[model samples]
Target chain A: MNRRLIQWIAVALGAAIVLHVAIVWAIPRVIMSVAMKRIGGEGSVNAFMHTPRTTHEFRAVVRPSPDLAYSICVLDLSDGPVVIEVPASDPYTSLALYSAITDNYFVRNNRQDGGLAEGETIRIVVAAPGAMPADVPEGYEAVTAPTEKGLALVRRVIENDEAMPRLDALRKFSVCARAS
Target chain B: MNRYLYWASALVAGAALAAVSIAWAMTALQGEYRSGPWYTSAVFGSVDADMYTRARVAMFGLLALDRRETMYYTAATDSEGNALSGDCTYRIEGGDLAAHWWSITAYDAASFLIENEQRVYSFSQTTTEREPDGSFVIRVSADPQEKNWLPVKRGESFDMTARFYNPEASIYADPSAAVLPVIVKEGCK
Candidate 1:
C-alpha cells in the first residue's frame, strides 16, 4: 500500500515476467527448431534415403495372400537382345518397377565381358503389359517401352570403378516377363 | 527491521513454493513411465516404441502364444534381411508367473512376418500344451518338428522376441530371471 513498497513490488513482478518469457517460451522454441532442422535439413539422410545395397541372389516373393508373385532376376548378355518368355496372368496387371526394396535405387555395376570399359553402350528391349518402373542410377539412361501385357524396361549402364560390380551383376538378371 | 523481516519471510516462502512447483512440474512432465517390448507396429521401423540402442542394454524379445514355441525361432539378420556385422546366439525359456498372457515370436531381417504352414511362432501359457509338472518345453532351431519346435531356415537371418502382458508382480520384478526357453540349433541343412 505504501508508494515505495508498491514500486518495488511492480519492479519484482516485471523481472519475473521477463525471466519466465526468456526461459520458457523463447529458449525452448529456438532449441527445438535447431534440433529438428539438423535432423531433417538438406544433406540429412536416413537409411531409406540411401541407395539400397543388395547381394547377389535371385529373389522371388509372393505376398501372404494369393495376389502376384514378385521375382527379380539379374543377367548379363554378351552381344545380343536377351530372349525372355512372358508368363501368363489370370487377371492381368502391369510390371511395377525394378528397384531395391530398401533404397529404391537401380542396381548399378553392369558391364559386358572381355574387358569392356566405360563409354560402351548396350541396348535392351523389355516386353510386358503395363509400365515397367526403371530406376537407373544417377547419370544413366533407362527407358521403359510399353508392351501389350506389361511394360518393357531397357537401360544402359556405363561402368566405371564405382558401378562395375553392380552393373555387371544386374546385366546377369534378365527378368522374364510373366503374368500371374 | 520489521519490514525487512516480513520481506525476507515472503521471499523465503516464494522460493520454497517455486522449488516445490518445479519439482511437481518435472514429475508431471515425466509422464507414463513404461518398460519392456512395447511395439506399435503401425509405423515403419516400429519407431513409436522405445528402441533401446544403448550399449549393455538387453533388447526385449516377444512370443506369440498362438503357436508352438518349438515351431518359432530365427537367425539374426540386419534390418533389411541383409547380413548384420556379427553373429549372435539366443534361446527362449519359460517361467511361471501370475500374468494372464505371454508368448514369443521370431522375425526375419525384412520384418515381414515369416511364413510357416502352422502359423505358430511361439508358445504361451494360454496356448501351449502343458506337462504334468506344470512346466513346458518350446524348441528353437532350424528344424523344430520333433515336438515343441521353432523353425529356423538356412541362410535366413532372424530375431527371436517375446512379449508378456498383464504380468504378475513376480514376473515383472524379474523377467530376465524367469525360466526362459532354451534355444537349440538342430543343424544347418
Candidate 2:
C-alpha cells in the first residue's frame, strides 16, 4: 500500500518474469544437449545398431547414386555361394528396422543360419521395412540377418519378378566376392 | 478501485500468458511424433498393429518403453533366455549375449518398416568379424554385400536403433540399450 511496499512488489514481479523466460527458453536446450551427448551418434545409446564398418561399401554399381552414404565390400569369404548382405535403407532416418540375410530354403516364419553352401550365389539387399521386393529367391524367404537383428532375408528367389533380373544385373558390378 | 483493478488485470494477464506459452511448448514437442499426410495416428495404430505388437513384444510395454529397466530397450526373454516374438523383427548379430556385444536394427514408432523397394535389413554384432585388433566395420546402405551395411529405407522419417547386449559393464553404470546415432548422409543426390 505504501510507496516502498509497492516498489518492492514491482521488483519481485519483474524478477519472476525474467526467471520464467529463462526457465522456458534455456531448459529445453540444456536438456536436449545433455540427452544428445548420451545418445548422439554411432555407438550412442539411441542408435539402431553399430554397423561392422563406419561406411557401407557396396560392391554393386549404384543407380544414379542412391541418397545416403555407402561403402562397398565384395569379398568371397569362401569359394561357396555368393551371398549379398543387405542393410536397412530407408528414406526415413529415424526408425531403425531389423534385417537379416537368408538362403532360399527357409520359411517366412522359420529361420536358417547363414553358412551358405559352397558356390551358391546369394543376393543381399537392404532397404527400409516393406521395401524388400516381393520377388525373392525361391526356398529363401526373408529372415533376420544374424549380424544385425530384427531384419529378414531370403536365400532363393520365390517371386519371378523384374527385381530379380535387375538385381542380377547389379550383381555384376559386385564382383569383389570376398568377405575380408 | 481503479488501481486495484489494474493490478489484478496485469497479474491475471501475466499468469495466462505464462500458461499459454508452456502449453505451446508442449504441443510443439508432441508434433515431432505425428504421422504424415497419408497416415493418422489411429490409422497408424490399425495399419501397423503387427509392427506395434512386435515392439511391444520386444520391449514388453507400449512404445517399447521401460523407464525403470535399461535405457536401451532389451528384448523380452524367458527364464531360459529365449527371445520371443510378436511379429516384430529383431536379430542377434555379435555382442556376447552374455557379455560384450553390440547390435543395430530398425523399427518405426509402430515397430514396422516403412514401405520401400528393398525388404532386406542388416545388423552386425560386436563379435561380428572385425579387423586384427577386434575393431569392426558395418555397411549401411541399400546394397549390403558391399561390406558392412546398416540399411535406411525411404520414408518421411523413421528411427534407427542400436543395442549393446551385455556391454562392457564399465561403459556407464546406467548404460542404455537403445543407443541412437544420426546416420543421415548429406548430398545423396
Candidate 3:
C-alpha cells in the first residue's frame, strides 16, 4: 500500500479533532447567544422576561431546576446602563449575572443584607465596567458586568407546591429599565 | 512546493487532533470526581474559576451557584462501575435522605429526562415512600412498579443525578464516606 493513504487518514483525523475542539469552545457562546435571543429578542434593553413555569421537560434550556422560579433579562450596555430592581421577600432571594460567554461573575443573595430589603425594593445598575455614564441617577447602585452582553437572572426557591403564590409574588419584583 | 504543502497540512491536522482530544478529556475528567456517588464541583459557575472549569460548565448551562448555594451531583455509572442501561432495572436504596433538600433525577444519555406514561422525571425527599426505618428504596426500570417506582425508558442509556441543597459539610469533605444509596441491578427485559 502507498504511504499517501496513511498520511491522508492521519490528516483527516487531525482535521476532525480540530473541528471538535472548536465546536466545544464555541458551544457556550452560541448557547448564550441563543438564550439571549429567545428571552429578550422582542423586548427592549430593560424589559424583564419571566419564565412561566420551570419543569424537568424544558427542552429549550438544559438542566433547569424544578425548585426555583426564574426571571430573565438581557442587558445591552451599549445603549445605556439598565436599572434592575427586586422586592425583598421571605425565604430568600438571589440574582446571578452571567457574561456573554456564560460566566457567572456576580451573584448577590439575600444574606449579609445583600438582597435583604425587607418590604422595600432593592435597586442595582448593571453596566459595563468604566463605561457607566456619569449622569446616571442616584439611589441605584452599580455592579459591573464583564461583558457588554449579559443575562440577569433572579431565582426564588420554591419550598413546595403551596409556596407557588408567594413565590409568584416575589418573582414579580424582578424588572429592568433603561436608566437615563 | 507540493511536499511543502503536504507537511503544512500535516501540521494543521496534528494541532487540530490535539485540541479536540483535550476538549473531550476536559468534559470527561474535569468535574466527574468531586464526590463519591455524585460529581458536583465547587468550581462551577464561580467567577474565581480557572479557564478550564469555566469552559466545561458553560458547555452545559450558564446557571450554577457556588457550593454553599447549591450542589448538583451526577452519576453516569453505578457504584460498581457499569454504565447505566435503560434495558436493565436498578434499585436505589438509601438511608435517611441527607440534605436540606435532596432529589434523584433520571436523564437519558443525551441529558434529557426519560419519558414514560407517568411523565415523572424524579423522586425527592418529600415525596418518596419511606420504610419503617425512614429508609427509602426507588425502583428504576423501563417497566412500571407498584410503589416508589421511577420510570426509565428502554432503547437508550441513561444517567442519574443526586442533587443536595445545603448538604452536610462531611458529605462535601469526604463524599466517599457519606451514606450514598446503593444501586442494585434487579432484572432486565
Candidate 4:
C-alpha cells in the first residue's frame, strides 16, 4: 500500500510540472497571434499601415509609445522580399521586426553606426536567408527574417507638439512594399 | 478500488495546481527586479535570454534589440511607496539621466493611455521644460499646472513607464549607479 501511494504522488507531481511549462510557453504565442490578426487582418501580406497620430490617450496595447508616429506592415516573405524605406529620420527612428509567434527577427535603428547607412532616407530589404536579389544596388541594407510571416514596425519620435505635422507628412509617404 | 480512487484524485489536483500557478507567475512577473518604484530586468529583449524570461517579455511585448540598445523601466508607485492614483497630484523630478534619450509615458490600469484634453501622454528629454541648472520637474495629475504638465484623470490609477534608449555603458556595468527620477506625491482627493 505504501508503494502504491508513492507512485501516485510522483505521477501527480510530474503531471503538474509538464502542464505548468506548456501553459507558460503558450501564453505569449496566443497573445501575439491575436494582436497580429487584429492589427493586420488575416493571412500574410505586406502593407504600410499607419497608427493614429496626434493623441496621448493609450489604446488597446499595453505600453504604447506616445512619442512615435508609428507605421506598421505585415511582412509575408513567402510572396518575396519586402522593401522598407524611411525619410531622413532623427537618431530616434527605429525599425523592428517580430515574427508571428513573437520571435524578434531584426531591429535597425538610427543609433547603430556602420551596420546601417547614415542619411535622411533609410532603406532595407527583408528576406529569407539566401533569398536576397543579386542585382540590388550597393549600400542597401538586408535583414534576414527567420520566419515567413512577421510584423515590421517603424517608430518616428514626435519630439514635441509642433513636430506632428512634419512627422505625419513623412510617415504618410513612407513605404513598406513587396520588392519587384 | 481504493488505489484507483486515490490515483484519480491526485491527477485532478495536479492539473488544477498547474493552471493556477501558471496564471499567477505571468501576472506577477512584472513586479520583479525592481529599483525603487521602477520594475526592470537587465536581461530583457535579448536573444540570449533564458526561455522563461523570454516568455515573460513576449507576453508583454517583444523587442528585437537587447537592453544595451534600449532599456525599459516601469513605475506604479510613488516615492513614498504609495500606489499612483489619478486623483493625486505628484511631481517627477530628476537631474540629467545617463542616457542618450529618455521619455516618461503614462498608462491606466488596463495599460491604455489615459484620456485627457491637452493630448499629452509623455514627456521626453527634449520637450520637457527645465530649470536653470538643467534639472526638471514634471507635474502629474488631473488638473493642469504651469510647466511640464502630464495630465491624468480623476478616478483612474496609472502606470508610468520610462524608456532609456542607448543608455550609457555604466548603467549596464552597475545599474545601482544610474540616476532615476523620484515621484513625490503632493496630495490626493
Candidate 5:
C-alpha cells in the first residue's frame, strides 16, 4: 500500500478506538438513566415505588428475579439528601444502593443489622458526596452517594407463593423521602 | 469533493467496525471466572469494574449487587459444552451452597423470564426438595417434571443464573472454588 493508503488506515483505526471507548463508557450511564425514568414513572423523585412481584410481564428492568419482591427509589440528590426506611421482615430482606453509573455502592441486609427485632425499621440517610445532612436523626445511618442521582433498591426474598401476602404487606411499609 | 468522500467513507467504516466489535465482545466475554458451565465476575456492581464489565452488566443485569452482597453465576451452556436449549432437558444437580441463601433462576436468551403457563421461574434453597443424602436435583425442560421443574419455551435458547446471597468468605476469595451446580444435558426433543 502507498503512503496515502497507510494514512487513511491509521485515521480509520484511530476513529474506531475512540468510538469504541466512548460507547463503552456511555452504556452504563445511558442504561441507568433509562431505568431510573422507567422505575420512577409518574412518581416524583425521592420516594419509593412499591412494585408488585416480578413476573414475565414485568418489563421495567431486565433479568429480574421472580423470587424477590422489589421496591425502588430513584434517588435524585441534586436538590438535597434523601432518607430511606425499610421495615424488617421475617425472611431475608436487603437495601442496596446503586450509583448513576450502575455501581452498587452500598448494601445492608436484615441479618447484617444484627437481625433487628419485630416492629423495628432500618433507616438510612443517603446524600451527595460530602453533603450529608448534619441534622440526620438518631438511629438513622448516614451514607454518601457517589453520584447526585441513582437508585435505591430493596429486595425481599419470597420463599413461596403462600408467603407473598405477608411479605407484600411488609414491603409496603418501606418508605423513601426527603431527609427533614 | 474527493477528499470529503474519502474521509466520510473511512469514518463510516470505522463506526461500523466498532459496532460489530462491541456486539461481539458483549456476548463473548464471560467475566474472569468459569466453574464448569457457571461463570461470574467479582467486579460486577463494584466501583472497580472495568468498562466492558460495566457495560455488559448494565445491559444484562441493571442493578446487580456487588460480590460481597451477592455472587451471581450464569450458565448458557451445559456441562458437555452444548448450548442450553428449551427443547433439551437438563438435570441440575447440586448440594448445599455456602451462602446464607441461594437461588437458581431461568431466563430466555434475551435475559427475561421465559413465559409459561405455570409462571414458575426459579428454585431456591428454601424451596427445593432434598434427597436422602441432602443433595437436590432440578429439572429444566419444556415439559413438566415430577419434582423441581423449571419450564422454558419449546424452541428457544435459555440460560440460568445462580445467585448466592451473602456468600461465604471463601467464595468471595475464589469463586471457582465454590461448588456450583452442574447442568447436564439429559436429552432434547
Candidate 6:
C-alpha cells in the first residue's frame, strides 16, 4: 500500500482500539446506573422495596427467576453506612450485595454457617471503603463496599402458590435503612 | 481539505467498526465453560471479571451472584446443535442437581420471560414431577403438554437458563461435569 494509505490505516486502528476500550469500560457502569434508578423507584436510598413474585409481566430486570421473591435496596453510602436486616424464614433465603460496577462482593444465604434459626435475623452494615463506623451495634456484621453506591438484593424462594401469602409477610419484615 | 476529509472518513469508519464488533462479540461469544448446549462462566459476578464479561453480564444477567451463590447455565440450541425455535418441540431430560434449589426458566431473545396464557415460565425442583427413578422430563413448545410444559411464542427463538442456587463444591470445581439437562429437538411445525 502507499505511504499515505498506511498512515490512514494506522489512524483508524488506533481509533478502533480506543473506542473499544472506552465502550467496554463504560457498559457495566451505565447499565447499573439505569438499574439502580429503576429498582430504587420512589423509595429513598438505603430503604427496602419489596417487589412481588417474578412473572412474565416483571420487566425491571432481565432473567428474573419466577420461583423467587425479590426485595431490593439501592445502597447509597454517600452519607455514611447502610444497614441491611433479613428476617429468618423457613424457605431458602439469601442476601447479596453488588457494587456499582455490578460485581457481587458479598453473599449470605440461609443455609450458610449452619443456617439461621427461626426468630433470628441476619444484620449487615455496609460502608464505603475506609468509612466503617465504630459503633456497628451487637450481632451486626460489618462489610466494606467497593463503591459508595451499590445494591443489596434479598431473594426468597417461593415453594408454591399457597406459600406466597406467608412468605410475603415474612419477607416484608426485612429492613434496609441508613445506619444511625 | 483533502487531509481533513480523509481523517474524518477514517474516524467514522473506525467507530462504526467498533460498534458492530462489540455487538457481535456480545451475542456470538458464549461463556468459558460448555456442556452440551449449556454454557457458563466461573467469574460471572466476581470482582475478577474482565471488561467483556462484565459488559455481557450487564446486558444479559445484570446483578447476578457468583458461582458459589448461584450457577447460571444457558442454552440456545438443542443437543443436535440446532437453534431452539418456537416452531419446534424439545424434550429436556435431567436427573437430580447438586444445588439446594434449582430451576429451569425460558427467556426470549431479549432475556425476558416468554409470555403465555398459563403464566408458567419455569419448572423447579419443588414443582417438577419425577419418574420412578427420580429423573424428570420437561417439554418446551408452543403447544401445551399434559405435564411439565414450558411455553414459547410461535415463530420466535428462545433460550433456557438453569439456575443452581447454593451449588455444591463439585459443581463449582468443574461446571462441565455437572449433570445438566439435555435438550433434544423432538419435532417442528
Interface Cα root-mean-square deviation for all models = 17.9, 16.6, 4.4, 2.6, 1.1, 1.1
User: What digit string (tens of lDDT, one per residue) describes model 2 on residues A26-124?
Assistant: 443343233233322333221122222112232111110122122223111122222343322211111112211111111110112433332233344
What is candidate 4's lDDT per residue for A52-103, written digit by digit as tens? 7735443445567888777888888886898888765564778778876566
For model 5, residues A1-180, the per-residue Cα lDDT tens digits are: 798788888888888889999999999999999999988976678988778888898887889998898888989898889989999775678899999999898888888746865446889999998899888889889999999999999988888888888887777788898876
Task: Report the Cα lDDT for residue B107, model 4.
Answer: 80
TM-score of each: 0.29, 0.27, 0.80, 0.88, 0.96, 0.96
Residue pairs with backbone atoms closer than 3 Å in model 3 (clashes): none
Q: Model 6: per-residue lDDT, tens digit, A1-180?
A: 899889888888888889988998999999999999988876568888888877888888899999988889999999999889998666588899999999899988887888897547899999999999998899999999999998999888887777788877787778898887
Please report, as a residue range, the 10-residue window in candidate 1 chain B with the lowest summed lDDT: B54-63
For model 3, give the interface RMSD: 4.4
Give the DockQ-based CAPRI class for model 1: incorrect
**Candidate 1 on B65-112: residue-level lDDT in tens?**
111111112234322233322133233334543443445555556443
Task: Tell me the native contact fraction for each prediction.
Answer: 0.00, 0.02, 0.35, 0.59, 0.70, 0.76
- Top candidate on lDDT is 6
Ordering by TM-score: 6, 5, 4, 3, 1, 2
lDDT by residue (A1-180, candidate 1, tens digit) is 898677556555555445434333333233323422332344331111111221112112211111112222221211212223222221121122221111111212122133224333332243232333343234323433221211122222121124434444443443332211
After TM-score superposition, the amount by which residue A101's alpha carbon in candidate 5 deviates from its true location, in angstroms, is: 0.7
The 10-residue segment with the lowest total lDDT in model 3 chain A? A111-120
lDDT of 4: 0.76
The digit string of per-residue lDDT tens for model 4 on B86-177 reads: 99999999976678788898887877777777778889988899999999999999988999999998998998988877789987666655
Candidate 6 TM-score restricted to chain A? 0.96
The per-model lDDT (C-alpha) reads 0.33, 0.31, 0.72, 0.76, 0.88, 0.89
Candidate 1, B63: how far from true, in Å?
16
Candidate 4 ranges with C-alpha deviation above 4 Å: A1-7, A42-44, A54-60, A114-119, A133-136, B1-9, B27-33, B63-65
Docking class of 5: medium
Top-scoring candidate (TM-score):
6
Instruction: Give chain B TM-scores in order.
Output: 0.46, 0.39, 0.87, 0.87, 0.95, 0.95
**Using DockQ as the measure, which candidate wins?**
6
In candidate 5 the C-alpha lDDT for residue A35 amounts to 90
